[model samples]
Target: MIIRNLADRNKKGADTEVVDGQQRLTTIYEFTQGGFSINDELSKRIVRDNSDSYEFDIANNAGKETEAIKFYKKFKKGQKVSLTYGTLSSLMKADFDSYNMALTYISHHDDNVIAEYFRFVQNQERLRAGEIINSIPDSLLEQYLMQVDSKSLLFKLSWEDKRKEFDKLFYAAIGIFDEKLPLGGVDSDIIEYVKNSAGIAGRALERTNLLITQLQALSKDETWNFSSGINKRFVKFLCMLCGYGYVDFSKNPKEKLQQLFVVNKKLSAFSSAKATALSNEFVGYTEEQIENYRLIALISKGSQKWDMVEERMRLLAVLMNEVKI
Candidate 1:
């Protein structure tokens, strides 16, 4: 009954998009458009009142005050009266476009607020039961990355529009895989590893909230340091090394990083001895050195062409195999 009244109100120029009760609104719309007669007495009463008020407004808009009397007489005789309804399809399209544009503008203006708003909406009781379950993951991912320190080297190396790409790459490097990736023993291992490295497991879980914000900012051709650039391949390889439980060997982390410069120079020579040097160096490198090694790995894997990121990964895999042997 309420749905019918709302539909009638919509026909009379009232705004009714059903942000909260879309299913109900849709059913009402179908009934109204399909010319289903309302048997609910309460619904009939509301519709009648609303329709009468709307007809009066239409008559006034048409400047048919005098003709209204004639129409009322015809209406009494059961004549069908034509009332102008607003162009609903066009209005809906405009509303959708306006909403999307507003979201885009808001995200650009203040991503943190946008992320918070999405978080709030997703947690709403009414929303949790909806068919849009996948949207939650996306929203959480976005919120997580937006909170990452913008001053970080990772952010500095990433393109603004490719935050989502970077987020995905980071997650993959940390062994999160994709959405289909099972959250079993392997997932626990990966999560534990990240927590141990960052010294905060709870915070790491919370960071997944930023994924959506990053994806929303992506452009068709945009690239990120860890995904479509050299950094992507590097991080992946480094993560693999970390997965193997190699610890930094240097007393000072900074000095350990300097060792990577040495490794980089030797690797540039591409010799059997260089490979041996890499294994020896890997065993004793500091955590910071491991980080730099990851960067070098990315650089080694990257290409100027967008198509070459994957190729770089493939090439790095070959180099890693040879180095391991």
Candidate 2:
């Protein structure tokens, strides 16, 4: 439920108007137009096309693919689409929940406005967070972050499908490096870095990719993927170390990397944890192992407690046995 207000955009530079979730909004809009049906039982309850009670003017226009026509088409497929009513009284008879669509309005006529908004929309899991930072104008660090997400082989291993999963990892890496992670994921401090961190974050990402490539070369499986929660955390750890010059990637670091993430570690999960149930469900995990997933409440709560995230990173470093960090 998002759109850009382009009322004032008679200008030449910023012409692209942002709109997200077209696929979802279209289906809902189509439903209001009586473009589909629900079930056989509900279909029977709807006003029959031939009935005098069918009141809309469009109902009088017979054969141009009406809702009733679509209904029969789906009924044959054993799948019901949704419904249509000829009168307000008929619509009132159906039981449904009331919902108010909340919209975020973006009306700036700058390129960053469009860019950041597009990023936000793409990351909306809620695609909202992924995008907000991308919107923060062209900073050297932001350009670097975007480059890392799209280009760096290390980040690519995770394959964030525009949800900005990689960016969150990147931010956490920055947070750990700076020791200033805020309540929300990114604050003005992070944004400033994204704008111009003097290419520090950029160097860290590049160095991490170097290590990842060397690690991949050591692997027997050509498809060896270093992407998982633990792996990603390790990656951020490596970046943190790289940023601080604490870890040396130059001297056969692959052995240490292998020690951190075993060569044959099966990163796949048994089930897609239903996030609603406070689940960290994964394959071969012990009860204590699953229970150790902390800071979950902050995941749902918008204001993240940075201490827990910092704690998690500390534990990963310990697991890596990187006393140097």
Candidate 3:
């Protein structure tokens, strides 16, 4: 439920909006409407209470009711209840670290979309507030945001798993390319550089769009059955390439697509045993090997084997000149 502070209202209306828990509110409304299976506790609680002599006032501080309190009163089913309240405007201005940590924790328990939603809000807020601390320019970031909001064809590509693979694609692209931005300079100067550095962003977008197209076609081909792990590793590797400045900014998309196809075909043959052997070879390099294994561990869940993702990652490390051999 949304509440508007009378003092804070403009000609259009309320200044506050609920940023989360929208679906829960819908479910509760439907339950109150007797549309879903409910226990006697819920049925008794949802009924309107006429005996109570309470009134809600938005403007007056003397008798004003909090939004949570007003919302909870309707469902006061004679049980202990607690509701947390947060304003959307305050959250938009929250410290970046706090917001990032919250999303990180939320990602562990909540669905992917929830975390993605926070990410979208955080980045959009940063752009709006002129927090260009990093290299990514406002214009480039806005373009990517537009793509996410629009749900263009590139984002519609499917994969073997149920995870938000398309979201991962965009995040990976931003993560990799953003690192290449010129930093440690004035914000205005950096923004100027980014605005003129269209070639870099263009190359990254070309690879990303081409990969999405290829994935879409491959998904439609009934005979092809690539594993989810391979697809993810492939995308991450592409980001590594773009992030590390390995891709020639002027190179045509066709050439990069051919290179990606070759790499994808090679990665198809990767196996867990090979990844294990690769890990064993770098046993003395504990930190490096552990990081490699960590990437593999991310996709190791479910019935499929994804430990081989480490091997592919190791290959990327070498290609990016992080490893001597």
Q: Per-residue lDDT tens digits of candidate 1, residues 1-325?
A: 0111132345658543323455655665564464343334443333233433324335445654433344334444554544211211221222222221101111111335444545656686434322322211333234344544533434434445544435544554333322222211132233334334432234234323332223223221133233234333333333323222232211232332233224444442222222243454466656454444444443443122222333433443433333321
Give the best candidate by TM-score.
Answer: 2
Candidate 2 lDDT by residue in tens digits, 18-123: 3766787777676666676456565544424322222222344565655444544554466643455422122122211112244444544466766765665576
Q: Candidate 2, residue 215: CA error in Å?
A: 12
- Where does model 2 exceed 4 Å of error? 1-107, 110-136, 140-172, 183-290, 294-307, 319-325
Clashes of each: 17, 13, 0
Could you give me the TM-score of model 1 versus the true structure? Answer: 0.23
For candidate 2, the TM-score is 0.36
- Would you list the C-alpha lDDT of every candidate in the order shown? 0.35, 0.43, 0.37
- For model 3 the local lDDT of residue 86 reads 23
Better of 2 and 3 by lDDT: 2
> Quick one: ranking by lDDT, best first?
2, 3, 1
